[model samples]
Target chain A: MTEKTAITPATHTVPPAKFSHGVRKGDILQVAGQVGFLPAVEGQAPTVAGPTLREQTLQTLANVASVLQEGGASWDDVMMIRVYLTDTDHFAEMNEIYNAYFEEQGLKEAPAARTTVYVGLPKGLLVEIDALAVLG
Target chain B: MTEKTAITPATHTVPPAKFSHGVRKGDILQVAGQVGFLPAVEGQAPTVAGPTLREQTLQTLANVASVLQEGGASWDDVMMIRVYLTDTDHFAEMNEIYNAYFEEQGLKEAPAARTTVYVGLPKGLLVEIDALAVLG
Candidate 1:
């Protein structure tokens, strides 16, 4: 059996529950759903990036990227992403930001497949995103 | 380019939008979030298995497994599962059903890493489940 590893980036606090922020086994890496919360600050409660969907969306992507990088992967290795939005109205806005972000990253592989769903979130958060990456 | 294949089992309806039911690129297969709807029948709208969470949860797992099987992977190949439950009170109930189901499957690999979150689902549907599987 291949060894399994839990990944926690320096930017993240210990997850609130028993799960890792990300886990990699063999050639595949799975990032837990990540929200727009800013990187942990000493002695401060977790906070969202801002009130706007765009702000939270970018920060959530950054947070998911941090976990992927910590697991020795990158956006280019990502094969899929799942976005959770609290409100249905934010769908188009998220895609616009999502498209621009990946285009800027200039991924070498095909754009990762994605699924988005409307879901409830903790108070004040608008989006949550997670990723799956494969590496050679 | 490594080939990317979209997976749609005969049991499922064509997804409403551009998204595929599941997507496989190389060794990885991603099953899109699935709710408790029973397999579609001609001329009938999609419907949940039952009103009870246990009934819905079981059907939801079956639905996810159908896509995994379509991609030539099984529960044993699954590396991670993210479960979205509509009601917070149903977490323990869902876990009980989840544990019994997997235990009955008698998987060979370590139990897949799982993360659960509270989320909204379509009316009368209590859960949504998705899986990531890695094949040799």
Candidate 2:
């Protein structure tokens, strides 16, 4: 059996609870849901990137990518992604941002399958995104 | 590079969108979000198991397991599970049902990491779940 390892980027603070920010076992990496919080600052409460969905969505995607990097993967390795939005109306805008971001990244592999749904998150958090990546 | 294949079980109807029920590439399989719809009957709409949380929760889990089976993986191979609950109050009860169900399955490997949050599912649905499994 392949050993399981927990992954936390060097720049990230310890997750609030027991869970790792990402886990890698075998060739698979699962990134925990990441929100729009800006880069961590010790002794400072995590802050949302901004008030708009565009700002938060971009930060959320960047955060997801960072965890993937910590696992020795990248957006190109992702097979699936799930997005949780607090407001149903934000779906279109989220997709707009998501598409533009991925297009710019130009993933070399087939784009990941994705699912989006409405969900409530803690205050100031507009989006939470997670990913599953398979490294060859 | 391993080829990516979309998986749709024989018992399932074509997904309403351009997505697969599950997708497998190399050693990894990603199952899309699944709700508590009962087994399918050709020419009929998908139906929920019942109106209660337990009924729906169990069915939702069975739905996830079926997809894993389709992809040649099982709950024992799962690396992560994300659950979206329609009601905040359902968290505790859902966990109770979830623990009992997994206990009965008796997964032989490390239990998959899990995250749960409140969401607004379609009418009459109380939960949605998706899984990521890695096969040796």
Candidate 3:
């Protein structure tokens, strides 16, 4: 049996609950849902990256990248991604930002399978993203 | 490199978009978000199990199990599950049904790691669930 290891990088924000930021069992790494909020300073609450959907999406992806790197994986290792948006109307705008991020990372040819759905988020949050990556 | 194969079970409803019911690479199987709707009758729209949250949650679990089985997995192989409910008020009701199902399946000792969040469903759907399973 493959044992599960929780990944908790110092750079990533501490999770509010008992869950870890990500968990890895063998080559597969499953990241927990991530919002645009940055890591809090100990006793402080987490803060959002910005007010707009585009800004939050970018920060959320950055946060995901941080977790991926800490787990010894990269964008190319990601097999699937699930994006949850607070408003369906923001879909197009969110996609534009998401697409560009991958393009900038030079992973245009091997993009991960993706699924997007509209969901309700806590106040002041616009987007949440989670990923599953398979390493070599 | 691992090759990805899509699983499309005849007993499950056809997805509305251009995605497969599940994708398998190596021993890992990733199933797309599944709602409580039953398999369609040819050209007919999919029907929900019932109007209540408990009924819909049970059907949704059934649907997830069908996809897992089609991909050569069972409830015990499931590693994690992410549940999206339209109403946060329904969390307790949903969990009762979810826990009972796993218990009845004799998987009470090691239930799949779970994360539940509130989200918006298209219509007539109370819950949506996605899962990851690993085969031996």
Which candidate tops DockQ?
2
Superposed by TM-score, candidate 3 places the C-alpha of residue A115 at a distance from the truth, in angstroms, of 5.4
Q: Is candidate 1 or candidate 3 better by TM-score?
A: 3
- Which 10 consecutive positions of candidate 1 chain A have the poorest summed lDDT? A107-116
Candidate 3 residues B20-73, lDDT tens each? 677777887888888888776888878888999888888889888888888899
User: Ranking by lDDT, best first?
Assistant: 2, 1, 3
Calculate DockQ per candidate and list them.
0.17, 0.25, 0.14
Fraction of native contacts in model 1? 0.17
DockQ of 2: 0.25
Clashing pairs in 1: none
Residue-wise lDDT of candidate 1 within A15-96, one digit each (tens)? 8899999999988899999988889997888888899999999999899999989999887777778888887678777878
Q: Residue by residue across A1-136, what tens digits does model 3's lDDT show?
A: 9899998877677787999989998888988898898755677778898899988999899888988998888877776788888886787687788878877887624355455778678999989999988886
Q: What is the RMSD, in Å, between candidate 1 and the native fold over all Cα?
A: 5.9
Per-residue lDDT value at B116 in model 3:
86
Give lDDT tens digits, candidate 2, residues B1-136.
7777777777665554444688889878888888888888989988889999999999989988888898898998899898988788889899899999988998675899998977776678888888888899
lDDT of each: 0.82, 0.83, 0.81
lDDT of 2 at A16: 80
